[model samples]
Target: MKITPGTRSRATLATVAAAGAALLLLTSCASSTEPAPEAGGAVAEDCTPLHEFPTIQDGVLTVAAMNAAPKFHALSDSGPFTGIDATLIPEFAAENCLEVKFKPMTGAAAQLDLREGKSDMFGGLILKTPERAEVFAQSEGSILYETLGFTSAKDDAYATIDSLKGKRIGTLSGSYYVEPLKAAYGADSIEEYQSDSNAFEDLKAGRIDAVAWQSIQGFNFTDRDEDYVTEILGDEPAYPELTVLLENNWPHTKGNTEMTAAIDDYYERAKADGTVARVLTENKIGAQAADLYVNGR
Candidate 1:
């Protein structure tokens, strides 16, 4: 059965709305009347058919995000959230004649917020799995492809999967990497943590031999800590692409085909005009994975 936001209780909606308003006050203190540059190097001038997609709060796009760095959203001490996904919000809101508000959340909670009407959308390096596709509508153009890898404090060679036979490995709980790593190594050889920060802590403290995560994330870690380094894994078989996701049954998405079409068009234009590539380059992430996905090698 297709679940819709209408199935949720009014009390739940009120709670979400109140929480979002509070967060908006705490975050995004700055506002700009001028829109960011779009794919064609021009600002959006009109939001035709704007009445079709109704936001949870009028004139605002509430986003649920995990405050992770590089590819996902990152919260600043006294400024707006900044990252690849967060950076896209201004242009998107401009095109839709809306202001942007960010709500901090992680993992399953972000998905829950979307379903409960706490947020309109969530984007933090989300992968488009078949299971998620059944409930949420993914962006038509991929934000980037993610390659998985292993990070370790030592310079030990990980030339083969067999190299990790008896070593302790850690990964984020509920990540797609868990099963594969467990199958390759034994269940007892792997440890799961609630977040990458926890896993990295174990790795740095020598509790785990390696931390398995996205290659870009691993790179981010190594960039910050000189003692650590990453090894890209599973080159013969590529990892899945990542994209931003919209709640399928939210009020803005319910029967709002035009808004969906406009979003897709924006992404397509961004891809065609090198906006995606430029963003990745500017942030110093996703270049290798992007090349691999585009060139098919």
Candidate 2:
């Protein structure tokens, strides 16, 4: 009996130690800093994937866009998941009583994702040729008027298409220039990559004679790396325009018919009332000198 009575104190001490250890474990797992999205992870939100709508709500519309540097700037600190088109899409969503959510994916992935119903839409699609019509559906709007060019090392000679004859021209695979360059110059003249960053890197290293890209991107590249230089080689001679893309019969996602129609109507009204021009002016996206429809492809 005396021995049994002595055992309770030891049991109490053991229990207290066990409780302290459990508390320490819990505390160790608690983070003082909030968890952030994993690298290249999509921003988590409570919304359906793709441009699908389970039920029409006076709420958010989730959009996925390409993280094409400078041009799309979808993840910039100034406005994370927001840029020119990023700004416009949400405004269009709001006018239709929908809130907007942005998701960023690679350029090519975003294209396929939109078709697979992973995103509602993707921006920054340049019309290099008419064949794009067979893929994603294009919107009634023109997003960017890209000025295609060839960038070079600052000291390199400014070359023309004719000058670049027989030279190795680096560009992105499936880019607007890929096919045309092959057609005009020859297949041997085109050296393509999945991402232009590597191509630009190689160009700077003298691995390629020239690199073709859009003017805006050229300026951005120069800003980032001093030795890099660029010049307008020529407009994509035959296919030189860019436009926004939508899902086929876009705004047709279930329960979104009304929402889509409203956007189309709003754009038409904005053009007629000049609200669109004012928006463009405020955004510094440059002015549309004429109706993009008539003057642009």
Candidate 3:
């Protein structure tokens, strides 16, 4: 589905209403010994096994996410979570007869929440790195692919890494680009900011020569403000792919094999149905990167 802010708000409200009605119905019928019916009154036998998966709450899928925009999660004062992951989480929960709850956190804290059993999973755009794979099982089929690039106020081109030498660069703190940026430009020349907005602001103010971030993020910034421009870096097809994270241990993944499988199935279906592409396009999140990745695939 195309997930514009308005569409996302409406969809979230509908899902919340449906979940509330379901909860009330379940509560009123609590005196009966019969098992509660699944979301659609009947569950596929293949999907029935997913009911064995344990959640943070009895019938709720608690998710920990960072308030990143577009592809990840976005928070608004007057509306529910309104990004790709945010919208998808509730859809997944409702499909499995569960209510969804989101807890905002900082980067990497979402994964930590899953490890500590504080949340059922990390519902944000997380890279499927080898280090993370050792501790967490990733859902199949990445939801997004990152394209690395640099943003500058002067609309200058940076096609080669050697051109970045001796230049002051800004990157988001705790981002995957930090180590590589420091390695390329030396640690002293690299400045890390707590948020992308801060880094971009510094870039605009001439405090930094350029800002290193995802091409989509840089493009989004430039698209919003006419003062900056972005140039994609590196010869590689794309950066790392993003996936949902669940703890690898028994407490999270043991009986939840089908739950993970179901997620993978949903991703495949979403891709086949163009839901992923539509969301990316509607939000102007990662359209260029997604186009390249999809064409390459």
Candidate 4:
């Protein structure tokens, strides 16, 4: 089932938006972008995507989302997908009175689909990098701000590699963190798990002292005030990833300027009016303070 903001409970949305706006800005995650945007001119309520502009299909946006995810997408399965893009995409479609067709694909497959014109866009929470721009056309909106970090049940001081020196550390198998963690600590101190759930379980059970994972995923599994995130800053030695200004952007088929422009336009209006943060909050994602996100591309 496709859900539009107009169809959803406005009261609930308002509450979420208020909560997001109330978040204390102790840290800065967003840089200046264009001022919100001017209001759109007269537009038809029953707009047809194909008739309005060129699309792979009329009235339907074929969006490819990763099949496996806990947030920014969902562990809630792909059908009627719910998450960041799940909300953002349909929100825009609703304004244009268009329908959305959700398709689940792996990251590699999503990129392939866009490259081959099999999909209009993919909401994969991919980091914006020059390398990716070489392939897919990136929409100007920001979905997430990602950072590589370490999380532990210890105090904020435990966020460092030296603090985890002798303690057993856990990380997802085949994750970029495995090598850098093992390098900084020791091979024997690192443990790799097949899935995030297992690694987090071990960390909570005290079987492992820490876990090296994405900051976004860490936020999902953890709420401990003492368990702080240590971002791998640029000044630090080269790490598996960098936390400095890594805004995640949605990718669309290359040369799809019309689609890209539509998404970007929607983003500016939403962000300027605080809709972006609220929608992300409604989907149980953070978009405030140091974790702020929007079109801060």
Per-prediction TM-score to the true structure, in the order listed: 0.72, 0.60, 0.71, 0.62
lDDT of 3 by residue, 81-147 (tens): 5556655555556556565566766655666777777877776566555565566667656655554
lDDT of 1: 0.55
Q: Of the pair 1 and 2, which is ahead by lDDT?
A: 1
Q: Please report, in order, the local distance difference test score of every candidate based on alpha carbons.
A: 0.55, 0.46, 0.55, 0.54
* Candidate 1 lDDT, 27-132, residue by residue in tens: 2221233334222122223544232466778767777765556555434322345556655555566556666666655656677677677777766666555555
Question: Residue 245 error for model 4, in Å?
Answer: 2.0
The per-candidate count of clashes, in order, stands at: 0, 3, 0, 0
> Mind giving the per-residue lDDT tens digits that candidate 2 earns over 217-296?
45446545656565543343443331121121122232344444554554455556555444344334322211231133
lDDT tens string, model 4, 13-118? 1111211211111111112242211112222444443224356876556766654343434333334344455556655655554555666665666667777888
Pairs that collide, model 4: none
Q: Candidate 2: TM-score? A: 0.60
- Ten contiguous residues minimizing lDDT sum, candidate 4: 21-30
Clashing pairs in 1: none
